[model samples]
Target chain A: MEFWVNRDCFYKAISDVSRAVSAKTSIPILTGIQIIATEEKLTLVGSNSDIFIESNIPMTINNEKILDIFEPGSVIISAKYLIEIVKKLPNDVHVKMNGRQLVTIKSDDIITTLNGFQADDYPKLPRIDEDASVRLSNTELKELINQTTFAVSKNENKPVLTGVYLSFQEKQLTLAATNSHRLAIRKLFIEAYLDGACIVPGTSLNELSKLMQDESGHIHIYITESYITFKSVNMTLYSRLIEGNYPNVLGLLPKDAKTVITIKTSQLLKGIDRASLFAYEGKNNRINIEIEDGSKMRISSNSSEVGKIEELQNIKEINGQRDLNIAFDGRFLMDALKAIKEEEIQLSFGGSMRPVLIEPIGNPNYLHLISPVRTY
Target chain B: MEFWVNRDCFYKAISDVSRAVSAKTSIPILTGIQIIATEEKLTLVGSNSDIFIESNIPMTINNEKILDIFEPGSVIISAKYLIEIVKKLPNDVHVKMNGRQLVTIKSDDIITTLNGFQADDYPKLPRIDEDASVRLSNTELKELINQTTFAVSKNENKPVLTGVYLSFQEKQLTLAATNSHRLAIRKLFIEAYLDGACIVPGTSLNELSKLMQDESGHIHIYITESYITFKSVNMTLYSRLIEGNYPNVLGLLPKDAKTVITIKTSQLLKGIDRASLFAYEGKNNRINIEIEDGSKMRISSNSSEVGKIEELQNIKEINGQRDLNIAFDGRFLMDALKAIKEEEIQLSFGGSMRPVLIEPIGNPNYLHLISPVRTY
Candidate 1:
């Protein structure tokens, strides 16, 4: 196969697909990326046993030709090597494959050759049917993944909790993730008929989120018993689902709270951050927040080994008696606050030992709950 | 002791000194930075037994008042914790030390307290006589360190090779370093009366280089039998000298070469970069460069498991014979090329296995030599 392709376009597609290629794989051929050129498009695919990503370069985009193909064929070259060569090469790269599968890449006066394997040795992507797919804006999907993925349990003992639990019903999509200590929930509404729940591995969701950044096109999602596929523009991502049931987390959030306070997001975030400097070095990264009067709250953390930090921030509103104190892991609190996209946040607490609910001021679309640490 | 210092200025001073503090140390006091405030200036010092860096913030700079000192005292606080607190605190930070050595730092509504050690527990910096010192521009001193420090041997088995060797006589300063495989040498002429040679640890020179990046003032260097001190307007850096004789590398460089090739610095650098892609994965990272007929050179590298690359770059000038092929480690070539601050470089090769010398086209102050690999 021989072709002259736009260097930037080819480099971008190769990079996107290479994210799925694992450096360590049981199957030798899985470390390589498969490149195929058909009559209309050129496709590059990379996969490990867990996930696969494919990106296509259309022969013509926006009425302008991007690739001039002399012959249509396929080859599988080492992804690690191909990316380095392409990234360093100048623009308007020319690539050709001989009958012996020797791939040559040339730009300016620089030439690189790599021995590639037969395309037949590379694994093919599982066929996904378009009729069983639902369409949603890429922005909505990205938001749902980011809002909950950070809360997934890192412990491998519970396989289902290691993935973001995604549930779809009627026209509403709900995403939730919890690590037993903290939980995040987000919902988006789309006009589609889909009913099912799938647990996508946290790593897959993170990679998908990064790939979909600045991408505003519609994403067509297809789910099967074993795998889920997300297709947008000329890229398709397939991730294997965890074979188990996600924990029921809706019951973990309480409907009633004894005290509630609304405070500036940035001010409270900075307070917790300063407390974390000392708390992080101790056995427990615990920071306590005490409600002082109606318009002020004191956040303090003490480490007998390090030192202590006490910060006071003014509250926008409060609806409860004073003298309420609660403690939480600094990391969990920081993560929840960082994901919020609002200036003011309302935190509701049932008691010193109960789970605290945090949500954006006027938005009901996202909520984060954390079980407070009991400090005696 | 009490003081209200500019947060940004204090933070910058702390960061510079903290670079000398080692987290893993046998002496507990060395892990902390010693802070001393006198009637005129406040000093911050960090030490790891081998090197000590001290920075002073004077009460006035450029005829403008910088600090208002209320009392004079000293205390030692954990360097790692102090840096974190100062960096995150708001502007106009107020610090005070109580009778029990409890240090309080406050900014706005944020308050942080740290238990500090008595200043008497901290080690004192070695005294060096300024009568025998030499003065040079900060830029000149920094350049001398950067140009030769990277070639220092990382292996500590030979303690002297781990430091850059400095020789001074007749108003001339010469710096040299080598890993036994490659060597870099630099020379500078300054107006000073000094005579002696000493070896300063490579790590110390690197940190000193970073600290002096924006300093344009003069640096007075004081050297004793075992220690060297670098003093500037408001900062002093003390480093212990390696207690062994440096290897003599003067005889390793030949006076004549059989072949010479003059080429653009960037073009040749890029050529080797591409060749390094395949060469680095191999056992020796060996890449062969051949001088073609007239003013053209072919740079190539081959890996039996990976592939091969051949790049041809135009040479600006050629001296002596053609068809001379030599092989060297790609990394060494890249490092040598990167250190040359010139548009063009001239490389001289004596033979296939001999040490090849690289120097800038017009500048002779710096030279680098790399031993070629004997490929059978």
Candidate 2:
């Protein structure tokens, strides 16, 4: 089999699929990327048992020929070394396979011969039926993943919490992630009415988000009993659904808050950012916020060995109780503020020891709840 | 003590001196930067026993007052934390000392109080006599440091080889560094006649290089019995000389060459960089080069488990012997090529087993020598 491909096109295809390549897998074949050249297109596949990514380069794109195929064949090459060779080679790369295992790549005055494995050694990707499929815009899919994935538990001890829980009900898609200490939830309207929840691993969502383009397009999601597949233009990503039930985090949020205040988002973010320096030395990375005179907010932290920081930030409006103090992990507040897109934010406190709710002003699409630390 | 200083000026001063701060030193005070406030200027000092860095910020620059000193005193604060606080604080920083140890830093609505140590606990910097000194332009000094430092031995088994050797004689300054396998030498004119040599640790020279500005100014270098001091505009850097006799490398350079070739420096660098990909899997990262037909040079490498790569690079000129083969560490060649600033470089090979010499076509200020490896 022999084919010549543009260096830039081939490099991009390899780089996109390499995100799923596992360099230290026990199965040696998993460390290689499967490459197949057919009459229609050239495809590259990378997988590590948890997620599989496949990217295709069409024979022609935008009326420009990108790949020309003279023969149809497949071979699995070491993803790590092939990328290094392709990156160093000049503009056009000529690839040919002698027998089933030896692949030769040449460009300019340089030539490289790579020992490859038979394509039969690669594991077959699972095929999920499109019986329960849903379609969403690429922008909505990207936004849903970004707003809630940060709250997923990094500790694998609780497998269910390590994934983001997705629920579709009444033409609305609800995404929720929680690590027990903090929870984030976002909702967006969809066209489907499927009523069920599935847990997709946080790492899978993150990789899928990177593969997707920000431009307007439709993403078709197909679900099976074991895996979920997201298909977009020239790419298909498959992730294994976590096996277990995700806990209901809706009950953890506070029903009513005694003190609520509206403040500039950037001002509060800067104040907390400064307070975090000293709070890092504290036992729980805790920073305290207190309402003052019904028109001002104070953020403060202290460490006996390091120093103390106090920042008084002005507020636009405050209601109900005044001078109510609450303390929580500074990192939790920073993460919530980063995901919030509004210029103004509203912070509500139930009490000193209760969970605090943060939301973008006048926006009902996002919510973040953090459990306060008890500081006596 | 009480003073108000611009945040940017203080930050830059701290950053320069903080390079010498040692976090895991047996002497606790070494981790803290000593700050002294006098009537005219504020000074910050950091030391790690082997090296000392001091930066001064004057109260008035060109009739513009940068600092307002209300009281005069001294204190030592943790370099790690002080930098973090200063970086986050706003505009002008207000600093005050209470009694002997507690320090308060304030800016805008934020206040930070830090526990510091009495200035008396900090070690005093040694006073170097300027009886024997030499001066050189900043460009020459910087160039001299950059050309030789990379060749210094990183292994400390033989401590002397880990330092750059400097010889001053006949109004010329000679700087040489070698790891035993490769050597780099550079010479520039200086303004003194002290005929002696000293070995300065490569790590210290690297840090001193970062602190030196690229502008044109005279650098006053003072040498004492044990230390060498480089005094630039507002900074003084002191480094202890490595005590040992440096072996004479002048006798190792070949007197004549069997084959010589002149080629573009960038082309040779790129060829070696590409050859490095396959060479990494080989023993010692070895790549072979052989002149063919008196004009073409072949760079090739092979790994039994991976693959083989061959590259033919065209040369501008080849003199003497027609066909000769030599192999060496690709990394060594790359380093030497990077340090050479000439567009056209000449490579001279004495024999298959003899050392090879590389020099710029028209420049006599720099020379690099590398020993070839025996493959048989």
Candidate 3:
């Protein structure tokens, strides 16, 4: 496309879309970013089979000229090479598309002509019905994704478990992810009414979280049976939905706890991390947690080859008269504590061999469950 | 060893010595650090085949207690694991020799026992005559290493070229390194007597540079036929010297030049970096430099698949009435420019195909020679 654009604006658009571009893709065209320059805006799209990211640079931003479109056309250029070229170009760059898919980008005294693919060879972005959309603030969505995405299964054997199960019911949205070893669940309130369930790839949700920078504005999400689209001010990301039913993880969490303890999140996290140093040398980084007199807790881990560590951390509040000793992966506990923003956290222990429910103090909306390890 | 040391002192000592520890070493004892606790100081030594680093933590520093030695003993503990343990340990730790080869490290409520290697199994530090020693500031030594070490050949075919040639004469110390394609030479005036030439491995020199830190105190260096040792306040690093004679690089530099150009080092570096982005797409990342009218220069590079870039850079002065155009590796030029601390750099061109000499504007001590690529 023949266009002149500011270096910063063009570079940002290319970088955002290039995230979806795969250099080792079997399909050659998938390695390139499709650029469409129109009279109103210039759109860049990049995609692999799983997800697609498209960013638009408007002709005018804040009443300032960003792009000058001399001719409305489209072309697909190598994502890697184009990004490098734009980053190295000095100041404003003028791009012109010649015949035979030859694109010329010129800066101060530098002119580079890169071979590009035909626009027709690139895959088309899916068309989603905007009417079926839900509006949520970027901040809320990012928080939701961060709190649960890490627990999603990375193994592709059970493809459905690799995606986060997002369920919506009358102004409330629940996000849940699990890899059998650990599970994370978070719920947030939204303004729109969206009563449906969709499975979004954890990878795509993580990328969406990074792209959603504006905290005040609401991001519009449109979901179909096979695809989902998240649209922001000048960005649109489309990702394919995993086709399968997510496992029911609601029952995995303990309903009745034998003992409950409330402790400072930072103190507990540091104790577990130190104990894990020795435990990690063993087969599994398993750390034992013993609650005494409801208000005192001791964390200990040991390895046959390495040494052992025992740390005593104070708890603020305790419930139930029974004492509990549970063993769980130290990494899971650390992740749960890190995700929690509150000063205090409540940990519910069912038994020594059962899953432990970790929740922010006085907040049940966000919960993490870790399966206890059999240290014996 | 039996001692109680502050966490900070223990952590620093472990980290400094751990640089020499290699997990993949064939020598099992080399994977651990030798800790010798004395009544006055605690010494930690770690070494692989190429180099050894030792850091000593004194019993007291600045009227503060850093180490309290209850018993004088020596033991070798896994450097990698010990460093991690000491860093994460809570508060001051008490380390002791529990048995013949068993070491116990205890913190507040954490206790870890690791199998320690016998002191007899560890290799002894090399002993060099202190009579033949040269003294130079740690800052100067570090600068010399950074300026020339990157040019050393990494190939083992010519093992001698993999080391930096260091020569001390009168009050001048010179360092030179070359990979056959390019050469880097740096020199500084010292307050020491004359010494013969020595070849220290570039890898070892790089490690020593990092350990030098921001200190300006003079470092004592001892050179022998087989090994070289650098001693600072409380640290000592010993490295094996490479055997063989170094090439005569002085004759390679042209005494007389037909063209000389003086330009801002940073401006030229930035221009070349941008041009290399396109040139890098080619086989050699070759960038062409042309000097016109002794005051203006043009830098350009082009790839058949990618585009081209050209920048007109301003030069302050040019000597001789000859226009020269030459092509060389952009990365090498960038390295030379980074090593130069002067604002302006002087480039002497012998011919279109001859090696170009890059030196400081008025200083002749440090010189870099880059071979030109013949373009058909």
lDDT of 1 by residue, A201-234 (tens): 9999999999898689899999988899999989
Q: Which stretches of candidate 2 lie over 4 Å from their true place?
A: A213-218, B213-216
Clashing residue pairs, backbone N/CA/C < 3 A, model 2: none
Q: Cα lDDT of all candidates, in order?
A: 0.89, 0.90, 0.87
| DockQ for each model | 0.79, 0.83, 0.61
lDDT of 2 at B328: 91
Residue pairs that clash (backbone atoms under 3 angstroms), model 3 = A112-B308, A113-B307
* Candidate fnat values, all: 0.90, 0.95, 0.68
lDDT of 3 by residue, A53-163 (tens): 999999888899989999999999989889988987778989998989998888886777788899998887898987789988777888899999999998999999999
How displaced is residue A224 in candidate 2, in Å?
2.3
Error of 1 at B315 (Å): 2.1
Interface RMSD of each: 1.0, 0.9, 2.2
Q: Please provide, for model 3 over B77-170, each residue's C-alpha lDDT reduced to its tens digit, 9 standing for 90 to 100.
A: 9887788788888799899896678888888877777788889888889997889888888877898999999999989999989999998988
> RMSDs, each prediction?
1.7, 1.8, 2.0
Q: Which stretches of candidate 3 lie over 4 Å from their true place?
A: A213-216, A292-295, A321-323, B291-296, B321-323
**Model 2 per-residue lDDT tens digits across residues A1-376:** 6788889989988988898998888988888889999988899999998899998889888998879888889999999999999998877898999985899999999989999989997888889797788999888899899999999999999999999999889998899999999999999888986888899999999998988854469899888888989988888899999999888787777788898888988889888999998889877789998886677898999998777889899999888788798899999999999888899998888888888899999889899999998787
Question: How displaced is residue B205 in candidate 2, in Å?
Answer: 1.2
Error of 1 at A79 (Å): 1.0
